[model samples]
Target: MIFRNLNWTKNGLNINGENLNHLRFADDLILFSEDARTLEIMLQQLSDESVKAGLTMNPTKTKIMTNSQQIAHNELIIVNSEQLEYVKEYIYLGQLISTDGSMNKEIERRITNT
Candidate 1:
């Protein structure tokens, strides 16, 4: 349901010639972008559209992650007037995703869990 009426292709992350902007599994969703401002726009657009459907969003449960060292500080990504949280790493679907863009942490986590 994200990016219902916005042009997100221009801002999506490209890897190995494939552009990826979001990943969705049932109700769980993850959005990706190279720039923080563009991401903010996407979230805003999603928020506006969700309102029309009478669906409310929970900003507290939302999270923002990035691989840049500068991180997110310029403009706060607020949906429903609430700023989202930023983290160094978060688990998605069953794999550990880190802002460092490395698989080492996931490997270690799996090893420890096993």
Candidate 2:
């Protein structure tokens, strides 16, 4: 697989015994990896392939979020030499997801928007 790292050193979030590494919906994509190194490798490979297909990913538009405390705040992932931002919270599939994995913000957003 292009996205799967051969020597997997970490695992992503597992739900009901399923380890999810990525999710793609339409034009939106989310990558999951417990190891920062693995995530970076996947992202680099994706960026390279996208370039080969005549697509350029906007580094400014890309964001990274991590729930693990092991990941340092300064650990920013760069694509095409531009650094991506690390966000504490962001909306995914119209639902707010926080790096801390809190649902409070999403709940409040739903209440106000509903």
- In model 2, the runs with Cα more than 4 Å from the true position are 1-19
Q: Model 2 over residues 18-41: C-alpha lDDT tens digits?
A: 777778887688988876777887
TM-score of each: 0.77, 0.79
After TM-score superposition, the amount by which residue 18's alpha carbon in candidate 2 deviates from its true location, in angstroms, is 6.1
Give the alpha carbon lDDT tens digit for every residue of 45-72 in model 1.
7778878778766786678987775554
lDDT of 2 at 89: 88
Cα RMSD for predicted model 1: 2.6
RMSD of each: 2.6, 3.3
TM-score attained by model 1: 0.77
How far does residue 72 in candidate 1 sit from its true spot (Å)? 4.1
